[model samples]
Target chain A: MKLETRRVTKRYGDFLALDGASFQTGKDARVVALLGPSGGGKSTLLRVLGGLLLPESGEVVVNDQPLPQEPNEALKTLRKNGFVFQGYNLFPHLSALQNIVLPLCVVHGFSEPEAKERALELLKRLGLEEHFHKRPAELSGGQQQRAAIARALAPKPDLLLLDEPTSALDPVMTGEVLDVIRELAEGGQQIVLATHEISFARKVADWVVFLAKGRVEESCAAEQFFEQPNSALAREYLDGLSRYR
Target chain B: MNHPPTRRLLWSFALMAAVSLGLYITFAAVHYSWNWSSVWGYRSQFIWGWFTTLGISLGAMVVSIMVGFALMIGRRSTCMPLHLLSTGIVEVLRGSPLLVQLLLGYYIVATALHVGDPLVVGTVLLGCFEGAYLAEIFRGAVESIGASQREAARAVGFDTAQTYRYVIIPQAVRRALPGTTGQMVSLIKDSSLLSVIGIEELVQKVRIMNSSSYTALEGYLPLAVAYLVVTIPLSWYARKLERRFAYET
Candidate 1:
């Protein structure tokens, strides 16, 4: 599968969140990290790719079909994309198992038993089999992040979108979650993540896109970008981010 | 589990009883009848009237829920006019008194529309008035569910209708139950005001009995008991509903 954008732009009342931004992804992919400062439209770009927001101009084509003009149709295309939100937005009322099963049940028309069976498989793989009956409040930060990943993976989506998936976890917990993500990428899932984890991106990403002022300042192979970035903005971002590490 | 406050509670209860007896004696000396037999004789009419009141209130509540649902959807619709129109209608109903609305629906609307049925007029008044309050409850409930749930439903390929019916609405209804029940009880009490338009509800029946027998205390006291009979069970059921669909937050 291939996902690409052509001059995709989104503006929110005088604020240009994304300005003619473009990128592409193909199957059998490694991780792609969108590195940017806050309010630089990284989240906005993720939303555009996930079909959650419509561009004021330009277009997005997923697997070669231009996204439909109608909001509902575009949203249908979004079903194939998986998103992991920052803060791990798990349903508070639902048990861990219920949270994981929801996307599958909604998308695939899976029966209750069948959905649970699939949820249990993902839970077991994520080392959360024991936490299945617990609510999100009962889980630790690491556990909630894992559950969020389990939910994102449950539908077997073609494109995975993650927004700061490990922000809440400690270093040890972050490493644990990243390992699960790396394994998914190795298994051939195309993943796009917006994160502040520069070192993790250096280790796992194949493509690195540095964004500044709602436009792509630099896009390069991860090794090349980190080793010798072409843009002055990319250099400044790397230097500023390195201090926190 | 501790019964240590028993003495204090009893003293309060005794004090309340004395105040009540003093008031009753003062009123009785002013020729309020102690006519127990009159209450017993007209008991069936009172019972029938009480049932009519329940019927009207429940009918109005059902209608209110339907109108409320429509207004809820309208408020969320894409058309700006529909949204504004419903919002204005809700405001008009909520801002005005139910008694005033009852009179208008019965007198002005009924006359202008040339409808003779008091029942129709009363029901329309009760439903439209109560529906405004309920619309806010329903809207608040729908909004209370997290935005992520709607996004999740959409991402899973459910259409807008399915998103509401299968995912958003059930969760919203669960959250909205307590407020909905409270609105319903308020509707029941407000049904009494319809008696002003000669609707022959429980309060109306008590007024007629008191006028005929001149046993104001015996007649109206039983009506208070009757209203309590309906409201108490309803209040209890509302509490049970709150517990059953408890939101921890």
Candidate 2:
């Protein structure tokens, strides 16, 4: 549960996407909410953590082992990490159950019977038992989000990375999906979410990392960060977030 | 024998047929002498020649298709040297005409290397020539698949090779099927050029028959019929392939 980044940086051609951003989270700090608006490097940071993108210069260490840049090595470590993208990038060709079960079968080499049983159990827990056989196209947006979460949880990874997990949902749908995330946190899972819902952050997050313009604006305990943020930007942002709500 | 309008239509058709036959007879009798006996005799030879050409084209098409798929995958591979090599090969083959490739295969490779078997040499040449064109078709189709699919595969822990194998190639092959079929028809037509390499295809056989029989029109007309007989089925099969690969698109 020791996740640390030492001056992680990324540049796409000439554009500096992330510049000297760094953070640390120990086992005690379970939920780290990366709160930022779009294009503020939150997704970039999530990608670097998932090892999907190799930063131009940085060190990402999980449980004391350095993450490698090679795709195979990164994939080996990434299998132990679950990422929920904003678009819920599920394989369209696979059924909901298959999408969930694929990680266990392919990465862990689980037998068909065991994989199917585990997949069904996760789907049932996610309240998607009836849509197991349906493809992503056949499901509603909320159901697709649930299936994406189910997939993320299939391998029972040590880290769960969510990028705007509930941003695309309606209020009612958002509540239904956030409840599942709440249950996951309650069940002692390590969750890191990049979310816009300040109230949800207040309720569920153990720590908040506010980022602005590719740098960390503030990092503090959830209550302290919400109540009296150190950075003026975070204070103004919270005020604006409340006003918009 | 029938009602007025029906009988009139039938009489008209019969009259047209009679006039057409009379015209054909008059033209042939005046210019080209009747040769029913020779036509009856060389029926087996014509059948044999047509089958030989069909068989050769079929073989060439299969070899070229396999080569084309390999080129497509090879060119798209992350290895830079392989990609460059495949690109060079495709450029060289496609830049030259198929007839030149056939002749080169017959003279340069076959004689210089002492391969000696023209039939094998001819088919290989046809395959190599057609493969270059098909490679472009396949590469374009494979690259056209959305980048999201590749990202999803990587997220699920599939290696690059596995992503191409499971996700990219299946979709690309389906997308490229129509282009491939068109290439196949062109390849079959291009196989006709192999006659220049002393391969006794239908056209070449017709040349031989014309030389011996001194009936250029008579000998070549049936050869044209033979070519049509082979091509008609192939065009039908191409249509069938388009329908078959239209599933997911």
Candidate 3:
């Protein structure tokens, strides 16, 4: 999951979410952690990578090819990549199985039987097999988030971009989601995650990109960035978080 | 939470008694001569008119919903001309009075198109009038769905059409149910306005009966009850739908 962004800029009204932000990840880095405080550019950057938001300006090169300027073309290029949002935006009208099956059949062009088969397999893998027939409102928060993860993974995406996936969960629910994410990361699934869970990032992230105020404060291997300080911003950020524990 | 079935039944009976008492007092207060025999003589004519009103209202509802859905799609469409055209049509229809629309529509527009049947023209015009209002109701329902739902669909690689189809419209349709039914009720009441075109709906028949018998309450009172017969069940059904959808929420 190699990525190189050149002076990417995105704005929301009067606020700049990405202010000439140039970010890069090392080659073959499967688990890249985008760590930032709330109101920073982490979610926006993840959204841009997921092709859900087109940049206001600048270039995003993924795997040596530039991202497409045309909106449909861009989504086409990254169709293999999945995204999990802060809120588990499952289709409330659909049961867990249907939520996953809909995308498989409608978007991925899977036949109904094949889509159901794939959806059931994914639900079982996510420990939600017993709750497949339940709508999102019927499931607990942790279970719904897991269902959302299964929906994302059903497409067999090469890259999974998660934006604050645990931001809306309780501590226990967050742990449940993180453990599943860890298992996926360990299983060699490529993931680019923007999160606030420092310890989890330390455990699983191969590459680290610390952002604050819409700019990259630190970009390096996770090990060296944690052990030895690269910049004052990174050191302060890390120190403040460690002080909490 | 719901009241126990027995409690609900008791409350309904009590409320019905109160309404019936109020009606009894109101009618007793009026000095119009009691003419139950004359009202009975016109029962067959009134029944035919009631059926006519029922058919017209139901047909108009069907046409209105179709027009409403089409306008909603057009207003949200990517094509510039379609969006503008739908917006313009909705504004024009909703801004004018229904009475004027029936008059002008039948006299000029229907005549221009050589659509001479007053009943058909009136029903269609009533539908288009209510359709403009229904279009906005449908639009509000669609917008009530959060933006994240669409993004989630896209993340799964659902295209624009697929997003609306598999994810959006299903939920919107449910949310639209209550408001849609409310519009239907309004349309049913508004069908009385079609009396000006001599369609012989319930109100038109009652008006003629009143003039002939020189009695107001005899014909009009039963007409009101006849309307309640159609509309009360519809209101009850709408609430049922709202409850069923509420479970999802």
Candidate 4:
């Protein structure tokens, strides 16, 4: 997946969330991680990439095509991408299997049997087959997040955009979710994620984009960016993250 | 919270005993002697009236829910005229007295429109009165759903109607159950007001018996019990529905 943003600017009242943010994924980078501190515009940029949020101004180009301004026309782009939110945001009323099947059958117009087969496949792949009939309230944080990921993946979207997918989990559960993401990355799935899991990003991310104060500070291959961050802001950001470790 | 069945039964017996004692004391305190002979003559009337009340209440309940849903949709519509019109009508129905609406509907509007059946007009007017309140309840339930739910639906490519039908409404209906149950009980009791428009319901039958028997208490007591008979079962059904819709927690 070729993901690119050009001069994207977004504001929420007085807070500038994304200010002229621009970056392009390497043609072969299967997993691109947006690395930044809290409220550093990483999530906003990821949302724009996922077609979940439209920037107030500027272009979000994915695979060399910019998203249309009007929402109706942009549905094509939105449909091609799947998003996993920070909170996991699974429908509380639906079972784990249903969480995946409903959108496939309802929105994408898949037959029930076909959607069910697809949902069951993903659940088994995510190691959630036993929890197929359980509602979100009955599942652990990691299980719920995995179910949400399955829901996003069921439609076979070209790009998967995840926003802090493990933010609500414990260290143990975070590892559980991260392992699944790593597997997806290794399987050649295209993913753009905004995440705080620094070491995990270093391990799985093919490309890295460092953001701070609502602007991109650096963008490069993951290993180089993690080992020798060029920008002073990027260096300090990495230094601050390493303090606790 | 986990009382043993024997203990629960004991508590139930105690409550019944208490209520029975209160009733006994009240009857003893009254000056007039009890006379079942006169009231017994109207057994068939009571039976007829009881069933009539049930039919009217069920009819009105259906109307109220349909009208309420339509109004809720209208109020939530993006079209300016529809939103304003639904808002204005909801306000009017909620603000004014039900008796006034029934009178106007039966005496004026129904007459002018050649809607001669007072029963139909009364049921509709009474339903509209409750429908306004129900519309607000439905709206509140839909609004109480977290924004994230809508976002989740949208992220999966749901359009406006599909979102409501597949995601929003199923959850909203669960949240709205308790409020709707209360409204239904109120609707059953409120159906007695339909007697004013010559519906010949339970309350109307009781009024007729009281006019001759001159025993208001005797006439009204049975009416109250009949209403309770309808509502107790209704409340039980609501609880069952609540359990069915409740998310596992």
Q: Place model 4 in a CAPRI quality band.
A: medium
Off by over 4 Å in 2: A167-176, B1-40, B206-249
The segments of candidate 3 whose C-alpha lies over 4 angstroms from its true place after superposition are B29-32, B77-84
| Model 4 chain A: ten consecutive residues of lowest lDDT | A68-77
In terms of lDDT, which candidate is strongest?
A: 4
The candidate that achieves the highest TM-score relative to the unseen native structure = 4
Clashes of 2: 0
Q: Sort all candidates by lDDT, best to worst.
A: 4, 3, 1, 2
Candidate 2 residue-wise lDDT at A92: 69
Worst 10-residue lDDT window, candidate 4 chain B: B31-40
Native-referenced DockQ of model 1:
0.44
Is 3 or 4 the stronger prediction by TM-score? 4
CA lDDT of every candidate? 0.83, 0.82, 0.89, 0.90
Residues B116-149, model 3: lDDT tens digits: 9998998899999999999999999898888888
In model 3, pairs of residues that clash are none
Q: What is the interface RMSD of each candidate, in Å?
A: 2.7, 2.7, 1.4, 1.6
B65-123, model 1: which lDDT tens digit per residue? 99999998888788999999999989999998888888877889799999988877787
lDDT by residue (tens digit), candidate 4, B89-118: 999999998998898889999999999987
Clashing pairs in 2: none
